[model samples]
Target: MNASFSSSSSSKGMMDHGDQPHVLAVDDNLIDRKIVEKLLKNSACKVTTAENGLRALEYLGLGDDQNNTSNVSGLKVNLIITDYCMPGMTGYELLKKIKESSVMKEVPVVIMSSENIPTRINKCLEEGAKMFMLKPIKQSDVKELRCQLMKYGS
Candidate 1:
């Protein structure tokens, strides 16, 4: 996978988040990624982005199976937010991978989708997603997420 492996421009480097939360925001859509990054940064979160699930997995030092994700290392984000309807791997699939990871199992994950299918939402929530948000993720949503994260300590 062609992982871009880059942090936000606002970041000085990998460990420069100070006391702020670091978030990994993944989306295949460029505009959506940028908007999420901007929103997270606005919420005082240091952001890193990935183009898709494979790239996000690579950035997390993970891959297709539990064994592949068993030894994750470096750039650990406090939270992960991914688009549910991505081309290669849906956010639900990505969520399973994250949940399977021993190193990343506790990291809070949020799935966003343009479609509000109850089955899909239930599946994500059942698989351990912290939240399932509708797409066009708003400033208010990010704000609420920040509050939730602070409250839950993820």
Candidate 2:
């Protein structure tokens, strides 16, 4: 846990927790984003968020359809957490974009949503989502995130 980035619920909700590895969260809901932020705060991990997949790609300097730009500097995002449904691009679409991206294919993604449909779950897995957590943002989810950090921190 080193750096943290958060976007404000009301006004873009941007927070910079320094240069640590980041967990990019893409969720349109303010409360959900806040909960994730609080949970990761304890671990001191840097967090960045986007309301949609497009914005997330911009933050990472990725082009349309998840293509990465080699000119960008210091854009090393570790994990991504997104909600399934959104106004513009769905989480699955975002995941697809990430997977298609040149250098981002290896980045792990976690899908968090209220939808429990098997189709959605299977779709996320097919798109390479590393984990799926049903919402309303439980403490266990936080613990799981911590475990993931531990497992991948090396």
Query: Against the true structure, whose TM-score is highest?
Result: 1
Compose the digit string of candidate 1's lDDT tens values, residues 1-154. 6648557645455455547887889999999998999998888888888989988887786865545643343545889999998998988899998898788889899999989899999999999999999989999999999987887675
Over the full model, what C-alpha lDDT does candidate 1 score relative to the true structure? 0.84
Candidate 2 lDDT over 96-132, as tens digits, reads: 9879877778788889889799988988998799888
In candidate 2, what residue range of length 10 has the lowest lDDT sum? 2-11
lDDT of 2: 0.73
How many steric overlaps are in each model, in order? 0, 12
The C-alpha TM-scores of every prediction are 0.87, 0.79
* lDDT per model vs. reference: 0.84, 0.73
Top-lDDT structure, candidate number: 1
